[model samples]
Target chain A: MKHRVAIISVGNTEYTSLRRETRSKAELAFAAIKEALDEVRISIEDIDACVFTSVDGFEGNVRPARVLESFGQAHNVPLIDVNTGGSAGGSGVKEAVHLISAGIYELVLVYGSPTFNEVVDNQQVLNTASPPIFEKPFGLGAAHMGSLYGARYMREYNLTARELAQVAAKNHKAAVSNPFAHIRAGYTTEEVLNSPMVAWPLHLYEICPVSSGAVAMLFASEEKAKELCDTPVWVEAMSSIADTFLSGYKVYKDFENLKILAQRIYKEVGIKKPREELDVVEIFNPFAPFELLAYEALGFCEEGQGVNLMKEGATEIDGDIPCNPSGGVLCTNSGISASVTRHAEVALQLMGKAEGRQVKSPERGLAHSWGGNDGQFHTVAILSR
Target chain B: MASTEFMNKEYNMHLDFSVSLGPAYTKWMKALGEKKILANKCSKCGRHFVPAKPFCEICFEPIDEWIETDGEGIVESFTIGYAKFRNLPDPPYVIGVIRVGPSAVSMVHWIAGFPYDKPEDIPDKIQIGMKVKPVWAEERKGDLLDIRYFEPA
Candidate 1:
């Protein structure tokens, strides 16, 4: 890295269901950008560059960055669009880090657009993400893509439905305190089990809602970060992994790609024991069972032992190595924004600015984002105060 | 606190795309019309692809060799759709990750041909690693759907 980069500020809007959203695309972008800039006490002119992350088809507009003027376009700032399916947010943030760390830009802004806002029927739109000829006609949607992992994982480990619900219940319980979270109903294990089954081995509550919201983050060089804020979360290490596009190419038994990614990142950061070394963590889990799958993939526990972590209340707010203190994407998924929130939430926790969902004085945290076709891409970052 | 009335606009995207099957997939799909399942084997890796890849992703070599299988696949994993959604089949459709004919990878398709007293019993009728055979469509069009679905064999 040419220069050290740190996260200075994060801006988030109140999340709601897609139909209930009142803010237009511009409004959503403006509100989040304004809040991020206001927190750092800097205007859009101060930022050197901007990065926008969202899927083209999901937004209905192929080039959403061109349509949305709130990303420093008025000030003539260069904007870079990043689209890696759901992992676009993480990739955008990584681009910002590169801009600063390369000594090319001092301040960079990454915006996580509400990707699902323009969809009439989310399932119809999501079905388009499948391979057009081969997989699309089979009626495989996002939930079905997520259910493949759960169905295979459960059979592999003899994991029961009640155990999966318990893992989901943890996130639902944590979301009650997160003001930015969309589904704050705080469903319990019984409630999750009782919810209507959308896909076998996955209840309706276990899946993420099609949320409407936006999030933005400010990344600055070490010198700029020192001048801008009292507390800044330093980017220790960041990297992402890619897999084959066809979902069938992957073995659904576990997050093998994520496991390989975590190993590479952990080795780079010299993290011997991820569960003991990291104080707080965030995982991209649109499906409830994914959190448990992620737990094993992230090396929080040994293989087939993620269930024990859930049973022991290990990932709760007060538990050792608390995960998804902001309720996670399992509760509120605004597509790309949800992936960006994983990093933003960790930064907030490290800065002691997490408000209702703060983990106690955390020094080191990990943020992960999973997206693309059946987990084609995964981004992992290690952040510290 | 503001009024709940939010003005909304709607736009529909009606777009069609024509994808080229290329040489590898062309041969594979053409075989399906004759009720034959062909898998392309990578020389370097010796791993077969069910859908017949143009090149092996791992070896990065062109898959020139082809082998025909009996279309018998093992259910690697599966999910039963229990709820209705737009552009998808009705409830109780089983989608399985079927590893056909010694292929290193699995392909997703519908799993059918089992007796179920009720729609809810669909999940119980299927199991991972269960052997299945292809059920060809009455009219073949050299498409992936040429095989209607896989059924318990």
Candidate 2:
């Protein structure tokens, strides 16, 4: 039998417009953690350990884990600082699940804060991710790297810029009901098209603004979850894969990694035909193109047919398989928090806690993460009621 | 941060240093002094690699053969960055993925034709298959910086 784990409670800080708030990183994280504890009616003494995730380079401070001792972690309990660039949030969730699966802790709290958005020239930091001696000289920032894949995809596959805009417009509309979302304002296709180009074929509005926020979730073993909360989001399957350092993997061409992960996740959860079975999905699309790519990659739709899924309204909030009901990274791209928040969104729907942005009967929700230059690292988790 | 207390000091020590080059990079530096771009060739696999590698990841064998690559290439893809990372040249520089010979692999380097003095004047009219050649430094001294960038032939 598989070791069972579940999310008992979820909490988050109101995603603050960067210009509206001026709080330190620790203060922001503390507020989210306190809210999560209060939601579950638990105290700091009851928490077993903490998994803190954030990209330190964005904070201009390396080793943020050491500085987190002030955030109410008990002296003896473990605190693991996790960082995996944009995927750090999902990585924290995977770490929490592993902690319970290994019988190391009965309950663990995972939290990721927003530190990437407040900094100036944020793209410069992303460009430095490659080896300084070799790759950095070429100015390989996220957008530049994304364009390489985007241009190739557009050229070879005949994907248009309008389809990319549709994703941004769709997510923006979804955020209208999410009071906690950073950007809830609706956008028109013309508005996205009229915006300045951050990178060619991608406009300013088409990309997410780095925002200030924090997300926290409580993870418990099956027994503790059953005894504590009325509704617990069970973790049916979770897996993570790292690609080659250079973007020379065969999976990119065949789009095989996501297929393999999705197949295994479905098998583990005893589901057939994900598009027909899974109730909701929150796939990371840091760039607008990746969501459509993921729709195909995750086998939600056939290859070269993701655009049709969007046009057919299958990915709408009330559609067959709602995609990104919480506005996703498009509305709020707070680096580390973006990926982590996807899990929290799924957990909320599973527990019937998502207030305005909740989906109906979301029995099985999929949260996925992609990071590294040219979408190198990936993680997928299947959460069910 | 250390210099904040002393307002009168003319100079302040900044400990912003990095160990950039690894072991295999020394050979590439030597080759650069002769105005040549060199990569290690896998004798067993017939593959050439830049910044020189000791072994081929695919063949799992030590690469004993070395090949001198032609400095002539074309700009396969390029980006004009507005901000600089740590220890790099000031912003608004033209960098490109240079495609050389039969190998599809492209090396990232600065583009010489770009006017670093007045970056705004530098045209964005560069094409994908434009012919270019490496611009070597006047005084070659066994370093990767020997070729500052590549420019149109």
Candidate 3:
């Protein structure tokens, strides 16, 4: 809180399925970094520090940050590597904010690498994330981890399959305008219901695809931000929460940890009404049901009333509190990159540069990211123009 | 220029590990072989942990007391796998979050031994908060798999 930090620019590479991706890891990093630097009209030498975010073994290389040339070696900038599973992207941004806010660095670059680019079977790798001795042998994967929440929430709230599909259908429709999205089928509610069920209460359309892409964001101190860019999205407040490593320890009825975290952060920033005060929002929804759960946890509506908000079209791009205008992680989940894009998308929306997915003259917004085994960690950031 | 062909390289890692199950997990796993479920109770907070925690997270105290449960649990939540993935079990398998006996925290295991006409009928057959009992394996190995799965009681 000593020094102020702001996001000046964001860079993104085109997204595609992991099987069809032609861009090499290094190439993807280069293109995204170049675009970000070019947008700010600066070179790598101008950056004070860089933060690389990705999971360790998912990249096939344990130290993926070292393998890629983030121009840190040539430019003599400190490149700090951060890994917190899927929330690594959000945690990396938090690190950059700390570096600038603590008066250590003026300008920092956070690169969200494609964490699942090298995987042959993503579920095999994701299975390793579970508690090896106890939970790993029960055939539990990422989708199954997500479905535990969907099944319990549906039961407690009497949420029908059609209601859950409508939420997924909303995000799919939003992805139609996102050029960077991997799956832009723009499926309807009926189509979502028709999609193959990967896990109970979660269909193929509700789950995120194994997308391949990269994203970069430029963070600067108050002075550097004012000097380099005209419209800088200011960081209002940001923090993350953690849970037990064992999935069994958590109660799957709701986002209990996220609700506690939102209360603390919202209280810190004096956000009385999250649904009214925030102009736009971006949520970490690798599973479509998460968005609805997050809506309740974020206090956008009363618990179990998320479906009502969706039914009324209140979260649409043109409606009040437009969420996931970038189509969210459901459409393009390049692992950590998708988490970082949640923040990057909110920044762009507040800066009036969201292109086709821009909300109407947004001044303040919120970005959230969830990761680790069965939502072990969650990061929430409040941003404003 | 964008190339039409992209070369891909394949690699594999076959690694094995032997993790030390400390005093708490050792006792819990050893009990499984005898068809018993042991839960360690935290003296400070009075919260019991199934798979027995060495210490209470909230109370921050080492747990030395333990209790033996009847091996019956209530399903808190469950998911039915309808699609097959590599290295995972076949479709129609159910994974349940069951709070065994008096444990404050639940443990995850497979839920089976219910009658169903088709694979798709599995989801409808199970319900949350349903009572389930352990189905012991023929050969006990002091492992989590000692109880093959949980069946409706």
Candidate 4:
């Protein structure tokens, strides 16, 4: 017997690489935490415990999770931190789900603060995941490694740069209406194709930028959800499965872990075909080629045919199955919390609070994220209203 | 509320140490320094693993045996970059994954001597299954840079 849980509120600060120098990191976090608590008409005192999701060394703090006391009113609370690489936000939400599912806490605050500064080199920060001896000597950094995957995927599936640009152009166009998006500009296919090549088959526009932001979500049990909000966005399922540590050790050309995770969640939620059953999808795609890999992995389309969805405009805002109506990670990714925002985006859509980028009354939605090296870690959650 | 809008302090924490190469990588690193490419053989599955792992992910067997290669491989995938990155060779270079010898697994490395005039023409120059050979550096340091890059055999 699974205990049902619902997200009462979801909020996040402005997503941007250039944050105000005057503001402190904790102040930025409080803005998001306060916004989420206010949506549910609950004070910080009402929340039982907190699950803080963040990276270990990135925040310039010894233990990044212990800084939750700075979240305005989160003090003396049973706080647990979860760091599953970039999927920390989704993992934190999952921990809260377990707490409610285990008949423990009724109200849990899920918070994440992913920060980076002007001094940090974005490529070097991510390249830390590479194995020191073999990979480092070759200069196979994060961006270079992603391009490697894109190159293989292109050669194996006969994918072209033009097709990949269409994915980027679509997301960038959608971000134009999203106030939270970091990079919001409608790029044409030719523009993206002609853009400087970061790696072969991938251009500068295809990669995600290093933005800074914080996110907070209020999770409550079914009884608590009924008392607080009229329309509760239920958490259907969350699946986190990781692969081998090295991308060099990956067996599959595409996202095999995501496929395995999607199958498990789909079986649990009784989803026959994800494309038809789900009304909306929010995928955490750091690169353009990843979006296509996700489409095939999540059963949105068959392998090598995700390009057809782009060509036919089937994933548009009003298409059969809308994908990333709030833009996506391609436009605004603040590192750690990027994956967590995937869930918040879906929850907002289901709660009819998606503001400008809301889809046409989507009842069911899916959120996905990939973290760590070589697309090794994948977390998926199915949400419904 | 306690606030700090005026104070801006910066600090750099620099720590350096050596990590044990363990049973597998220790052997592989030493072999690379000696101008040899090595792959760990999974005792149970009998498969070769490049960039050696302690055990097989699929079979869960400790890598007991090793295999040596003549530094020949085929291009599994290739990507050419035009921008210059820190501590790397000049611009307009090819980097790719190559399946060394008869191993099922591939290693990521630099692919030099790729037939490409402009960055735009790189997509058509290198294809999967292209033969390549390693080009070692003059001063070998028993690291990844021992073999400078892999070129058309």
lDDT of every model, 2 decimals: 0.92, 0.74, 0.92, 0.79
Higher-scoring candidate on lDDT, 2 or 3: 3
Instruction: Show where candidate 1 strays beyond 4 Å.
Output: B1-5
The true-structure Cα RMSD of candidate 3 reads: 0.9
RMSD of candidate 4 to true structure, Å? 2.6
Two-way TM-score contest, 1 vs 2, winner: 1
lDDT of 4 by residue, B2-97 (tens): 565456577765769687778787788788888899877888888887766788878977778888988798887766766666555466777777
Give Cα distance to truth, residue A217, candidate 1, Å.
Answer: 0.2
TM-score comparison, 2 vs 3, better candidate: 3
Better of 2 and 3 by DockQ: 3
Docking class of 2: incorrect
Q: Give candidate 3's error at residue A278 in angstroms.
A: 0.1
lDDT of 2 by residue, A1-385 (tens): 2478999887788786665656556767788888888877888778788888887666666776677653455556678888777778888899999999888888899987785744556676676676566676566667656555454455446677787788788888888888768888878777877776655545677677768888888999988888888899998888877654553222232345667777777787787888998888998876677777788888888887887999999998898999999888888877788888989998898888888988887898999987765566778999989
Candidate 3 TM-score to native: 0.99
Candidate 1's TM-score reads: 0.99
Error of 2 at B70 (Å): 2.9
The TM-scores that each candidate's chain B achieves against the reference are 0.96, 0.70, 0.97, 0.80
| Candidate 3 segments whose C-alpha is farther than 4 A from its true place | none
Report how far residue B75 has shifted in candidate 3, in Å: 0.7
Which docking category, incorrect, acceptable, medium or high, applies to candidate 3? high
Over the stretch A1-385, how does candidate 1's per-residue lDDT look in tens digits?
A: 6799999999999999988888899999999999999998999999999999998778898898898889788889999999999899899989998989999999999999999988877877888888888788999899999999999999999999999999889999999999999999999999999999999989999999999999999999999999999999999989999988887787887899899999999999899999999999999999988998899999999889999997888888998989999999999999899999999999999999998999988999999999898899999999999
lDDT of 4 at B132: 90
